[model samples]
Target: MMRRWARAAVVAVALIAVSCGGSETTETTASITDPPQINRWVTVGGIEVPIGTTDGPRGGEWEPFAGFSHTPQGAALAAITQSVQLSTASDRNWPTILAGVAAPGEGRDLYAAHRGLVEISGTDPEMVPTIVGYTIADYSDTAATVDVVQRFSDDSLASSTTEVVWTDSDWRLHLPSDDTATITALDAVPSELVNLEETRK
Candidate 1:
């Protein structure tokens, strides 16, 4: 469960950073327009994540995760891209992924330090969790919360709530100061969830 382990490792920063300190943010929703297309899927550390053709990753020449649009679709795409990167990051690329996707501050440092302490493995490509759908739970010009639904090899479903903030012309994953970001097991995908797989089909 490399994907699940990575997810836990990153989310566990709440407790790990208690002694170090973190950052906080508020959620606000305006109107959302222009749903981004799942132009393709890319495999990172054996985990698959969608890439958008229109909304972002507009700049991947320097860093694969460097360029993203500042729109709602960009934020959502960024949240999904960053989530998969965080969940699948290994020693080989964790630092690069963290640097490109994570917002700068105590939180990112804490996450990096915590991941550094652990030796991660078990990235069985067949068993890894696959992102199935997503919902933009909340959105504003500055911040957005995206609920990403992932289905593991066992066929069970879970949703990770990722919050990203606009920073320096791009959207970066924002680990909540209080460790409030969460992954919840789901009985079934919520009706409101947008199925990116369906869109791709």
Candidate 2:
């Protein structure tokens, strides 16, 4: 449980850096207002926002995870788009959280066991982040992956590669084990978003 939360938090940092990190954000044709609705997510520059299943409409929290794009890539992008939103949402609004996106049967079981294991404070989130652009990083007949550039409000930038698998219901994100550990283990340096003022100085 602890490890999953750690992985989820690190994944959040990575995605946020990607969504909001770049020095200059690419103009996006995609846009949306907050509270994110139930199941709807946005995609821009081949990067789709990812949000997984909610507590369901029971609390009026979210709609069922349905209405995905029929195309495999499209469906994967859609789920990822929502995942980004969930990471940025007020932790308190989601007091109980599930760590990853997974298949219905296996996913539901995991969620049931781990639900409420994580708590988000529901604090007002920082500047809204955005998915600027992405490219298909890897692909198989049944699976697909995306490498994305994400942006934060201050124009800080980061990049991440996400994966997805097709399930009977639709596509779901394939979260890495210990996402933060995984990144650090790669022995990579963090990229700082350049400041124009600093450059000028």
State the lDDT of candidate 2 residue by residue for 1-201, as single tens digits.
445334434544544232210012122222211112234334322233443233111111232233343243343343345345344334343223222234334533543443346654432334344554444555553466655444544445445566656554344555444323111111222232211111111
Error of 1 at 174 (Å): 0.5
Steric clash pairs (candidate 1): none
Q: Largest TM-score belongs to which candidate?
A: 1
- By summed lDDT, the worst window of 10 consecutive residues in model 2 runs over 18-27
lDDT of 1 by residue, 29-148 (tens): 323544567677876656666778766664332244746666677787787777666656666777877777778887777777667888767465545667777788888777888877
Per-model C-alpha RMSD:
6.6, 12.2
Q: Please, what is the whole-model Cα lDDT of each candidate in the order they appear? A: 0.65, 0.38
Best by lDDT: 1
The TM-scores of all predictions, comma-separated, are 0.77, 0.48
